[model samples]
Target: MFRRIKITLSLLLTLSLLLIYLPQSLPIAGAAAAGQASQIDAVLVVDVSNSMNTSDTDKIGNEAMKMFIDMLSTKGDKVGIVAYTDKVQREKALLEIQSPSDKEDLKKFIDGLDRGPYTDTAVGITEAMKVLQHGADPNHEPMIVLLADGNNDFAKNSGRTQSQSDKEMAQAVQEAKDAGIPIYTIGLNADGKLNKQALEDLANETGGKSFSTNTADDLPQILSEIFASHLKLKVVPIQSMTGNGKFQEVTINVPNASVLEANISIMSSKPVETVLVDPTGTEVAVPSDNVLLSKSKSYSLIKLLTPAEGDWKLKVKGASKDKIDINLVFNYDLELAIDPIPSKTYKTGDKIDIRASLTSNGQQLPNTELYTNMNAVLVVKDLDSSKTEEIKLTNTGDSFEGSYTIADKHEYELTVRAEEKSFYRETEPVTVSAKGTTSSSGSAGVTTPKPADVEKEDAKPFPVMLTIIWGLIIATLLGAAILIMKMIQKANKGFVGQLVIEIRDENTNEKTFPQYKKLGAFKGKFNLHQLLQLAPELKETEGFIFIPGSNDRIIIRSQNGGTLEKSGRAVDISKGLELKSGDRITVPLSQADKTIFLEYLV
Candidate 1:
């Protein structure tokens, strides 16, 4: 009985050892529980721009917030909130709880947010940093998740320009980087016109990831994946190529885990030779070596050398068979090229004839069949209307010509794309101006008026013309009455003639007289000839004349003889001279002297 009991005890001990040592095949109870221990601290910065006031933005925000809260709650971690507009209005403390709480506070904050007219992202980041600095402990990893629909337009003070705001915001980001904070940015727009580049830079600098979202509905799933599988993947070497004009052997190494299988394949713009080998140094079936591996395996070697130089892709499928997880790496080599082909520009209802010659490195390619596989798009946009038209090209060997007629005047840009194998070259831009046709009237050959002349003719002339006629009539009546009264008194008024004089003042340089035209009376319009007569001293070289009420003297010169036509217009000259009791008028002479042109009727 003692011998039998000893054998039975040894068998039980052996069974317990098998359960403890071989955990992979055994039913492990706490394997998932071990994974839950590692948690991360996440901060979400959301944009509440006026443009994001739609139901889509609200739904995405709510769903993403719910997922984040759920994940963090499960991990017993803390999550913070920052609701931003043109300014950061509401912020919540990082809530750390042992049990999941209803997201009432977060929902309330989101509901109360008022969509702002503008965005000031710099201020929002500063506010977020304050919350993060206070909430994050030294032991936990801190990450910032930024969501924005627009660029940074935060101003230091009122009246700041866009460029000034950009500079301030860039400095603020640099400050955050210095404080050891990592930022993960998400662009919610497809075109990425906003602060996308800035957000990407923030992510790269802070050792965080950047993601782009095309549709708002994809946000929840993407965020969930981010939280669930937050593993950091670092590519070793990052680049590898086959040598010796053929693909013969290739190798890849993954640290921290043994590689179970690796399958390699090559793709190029042009066909070339290829060969592949497995990890066990065994040759696999090379059914058309150009295509390479097609199965899931532990190790693979690819050998390929391409003839064309454009873009090439090498796909590497690797699996950690020991862990039952697979990983993939894609290697890309893109070549650069230059091709000269004159693209065509066309208007609607007009036909386009396109002719092109393709050459590379100063050598013309062989007589290859020209494929007219091109797509043409026409976008017409104005203040009140917009329309778009898409046209597909038909294959025409060597050369292609087509016509399109346009109905209205517009500015258009045409793009032509040519592809051969993996090589593609886009032609330079072509602009087409399409305007409605004009009909000729009579034999005048389409008389089109100059824009400037048309504008001048359109100006109103009623006010100016009436004023001139009235002033001329009044001046004529007054001059006739004064002359008749003076003649009756036998006043010795001087005859009309050119009188030249030079006058100077203490302060400024002399200026030339401007031409003024005079009509029939003092109230009549003064022409250029009258202006010369009034300042005859201007006729002499370097001589100047000063009118009574004017501030500056005017220089005058004569091109022909000093004689010039004078108007019969008259004016009172009593204020500008020290007249004698019998003097009616005084005139300035060429000798820097004053002469009486008319005697006063005493």
Candidate 2:
């Protein structure tokens, strides 16, 4: 009987999990077999920064993209162009590739494009996303294929932090992920100075892949990989289970799945911990190498290329206190791949070779046409010396090659011009810093602190109302002190009597002892806590003791030399202080204690 019950319980658990599947109650493979998916819309976001123009990344990228478009048999598929520098410029609006002729317009758009001043990648991504909404096939899922050669230089131009740039990118990626869109990023060269890791991180967070190439000639092959394998995926939506308070748990059931990609976002500002549990009931490790930490571990995005099919559970903590939860689910996504790797970085004295990678949207141009269709010019400038020179670079193949010597120990700006188009990269501008030179300034030698601030004009006077109020307060106090001293000298204060204090209930008309208090909350209690409220000076004691002087005059002095008043007038009681019968004594309380009251045996 015990064995049967255990078996029954196990069966019930499995049955409960079966309900975790999508509302359709069918597997993804089964859905795909049903033939429901349609065209996938893609946005081509190009970096029109100076670096792309100078390094020929823009030219190579254009040829590579046009070749990829030619290879794609996307009959009804739509593609849009998003070119950006400091802002987004939608060159060719979202257009469908109805026939082979539409490819030429796109090629022309890429060929005629020019470089912009700064790199606003986040702005480009955001604007590109909006472009996907117009004239888009409702059945298609949108994707952004972004290519960047350098880091976002908008920080220096806009006078904001790189963190703001990072946050903006993260937010845009999150928005894409929420809309079931994936972002595939291609980085030309992000060697810390260019922020290549940020591109990789954004890709990871969005369940997308990051590609990189050092040279411009090999960029077209990267573009080819994105178009060659157009994997069509069906969107699966499962019933969501809600959890609360720190560690919220949710399960994503990917039945008969080959690839699993997910984005987990905490609906909170505070950082949270997101852990994944496989179908085998074992917790998956947070791979430090694969994770992209944005804004200091605030975003948790994980991508699983080959996931085990079972009940994949997502566990999140940190948002429980705020009633915030994590949004985690499997989204259909893909990434671009780079080929022919190991692109080199050229220095000041090193010669850089630019070759025959130029192509319009139609065909790849040959190296011989470089002289007629394009001419390369290299301009170098030393900021410290304010010296500059322009030299004609020689074309190697479909590219140009040039070399220069570092003669000045100052920052430099290297620009490339081809066919009346000038290209400039925002990354380390002509970074040929002189050896053995040190300064208390930031990289780029732009921001430096001053030794002294410039002097300003003298401060003006206070307001008239403020000046009059302060003057009256000082004069009144001085006048009262003089009057008190004069009266003390003339009055006779030699009378004697025993000092006594009479206590009466202000509301009840009944006399009470010193320890009595109206402790309504703790009524019928004669506790020392009540006595402390009456005479706080006897803070640690339960009672007070006083002795009368031989003379009837009573003197009260403050230990801290604080001011005291009688009948709203200042008193010089510190010098031979005296009091009389029926004289009510009221002592002001310190900031930390309540006011006290006494009577001279009236």
Candidate 3:
């Protein structure tokens, strides 16, 4: 019995030691999975000409615009509106959507849109660009969506002539292209009088899409497509329903946690009601903290914020004869990255292979059904001629691969764009120089210099004296850099002013006088032993160190057994807490005994 008791105690001792020495690891999985979402700034340039009054007698365009506004997430996305005829008629500066109230206000503004006498497409485009230029976010992706009949109508005595207006329009489009802002054009061809070619030119020149429809009723669908394309998302079609005045249930998968938002749009001839059931079989209430429901005359939209990863059930109710079409657009926080190019230069006619992949939480996404429907393309641009070309890529299980042939000797910029039925991503542009047979000036033929001229250029003597002079200059600069580095190192070894400290007892409410000590007197680290000399009453403090940090700040590092606080909030001092001037820190000297109060006086 004695031997067995001793063995049991030894095992417990070993376990205690292991616990004391084990490293503490934080739970970091999925903590950085969904990073910050990129913001979007969009401008709606609408043509409210007299022709629109006839082409859209019911003002369906207004309803479409309102739907587009409702689709925007309350995630700091900005929007502007420009209604124009021969000149700017009404304008709304860029407004950020922070809540449901902001979207309602914007829709109300769209409701008051009135028709004007004539249409000058140039005026509409320019005023929209002006609104963006005045109040655009530098970090946001900016775009302009123009809705027009594409007619160039100017009343007599209007300040601008047709030729001048055309010139201004061309210049404005070029400016937008230079600023990397795409102009999406929606042409209403209800009367078959739409200037189709004009609208296409505007979109094609600025890397945007041109959409047209013959019936005004199609305006809402077109608007939804434009909104999705502009934000690199896709319009996923759900089941179409023939309502029977009873609630019908449909199941939709939320897919993955990378999705930042899921906007489900229900388009119908009349307003339909909806109810949502989450994956856990819990009924989700509309207008709650995580769900937003927007209803209009022709549509009802439900936006789910950071939806759970699983299947979701949605119930819909409408009139007996109503037709309801449902669709979903998912906004993801995943990033697509292209592998680095093997070389920075290539010969003409060489085939360059590109590979790209998707990542969330900085980890590559595995091969799954998500890549089966994805489309990848390589966009090549000539640096000198400003020409662009797209090459399609195939999905190779978990990655995308494609090859492009270099046809000229000029420098080219390359970007890989990968898109799925739900979201799209593009990489930053990379440059590569191609050298061979083609002329840089884009001429039909290449011209080669004569052998005699090449020999003459090669025969020139090397400048030894100039080389030596440059070598000495570089040496001098390197010495100066080394000297400056040493000075900076020396300056960081000490800090100004002393640390003032006080001790207080929690059980007895006893206090101690203030004690001051120069932090520079201790080299490298200030341990508890050094501090105990200044105030012997603070003997309870152990395993604490103070190090001089940059900018007159002191770093406080603590071990186990006490709590550190700043202004009544617990401070995590396991790593270090930077205490600046005028900041006060308190650490309990024991579990239920005295406390140490510290402040830096500079």
- Model 3 regions more than 4 Å off: 1-36, 347-354, 360-414, 436-602
Off-target runs (Cα >4 Å) in candidate 2 are: 1-38, 155-160, 190-194, 229-602
Q: Between candidates 2 and 3, which one is better according to lDDT?
A: 3
Q: Which candidate is the best by lDDT?
A: 3
lDDT (Cα, tens digit) per residue for candidate 2, span 314-378: 77666434434333333222211111211333234533332222332223344343333345566
Summed over model 3, clashes come to 0
Which pairs clash (backbone N, Cα, C closer than 3 Å) in model 3? Answer: none
lDDT of 1: 0.43
Off by over 4 Å in 1: 1-36, 54-58, 102-104, 153-157, 190-195, 228-602
The C-alpha local distance difference test score for the whole of candidate 3 amounts to 0.79
What TM-score, computed on C-alpha atoms, does each candidate reach?
0.32, 0.33, 0.62
* Top candidate, metric TM-score: 3
Candidate 1 C-alpha lDDT tens digits along 1-602: 99657645554554454465566675565533322223456677887766565424444654555544543422235566776766665565555433323344444455565566557666667666766664454545566777776465444466756776567667757766887677777677744455567778767876667777766655644554445333221112224343334333334332111121122323221233433343354444554433233221212223221212222333332222221111232221111112222233324565444433333332333433323332322222321234545444433454333433444556555445444321233444455554433322232254668998889888857588788986775566456545555543432221221233223322353432321111111111112223233223333422222121112111122333232112333433222222222333323334433222323221
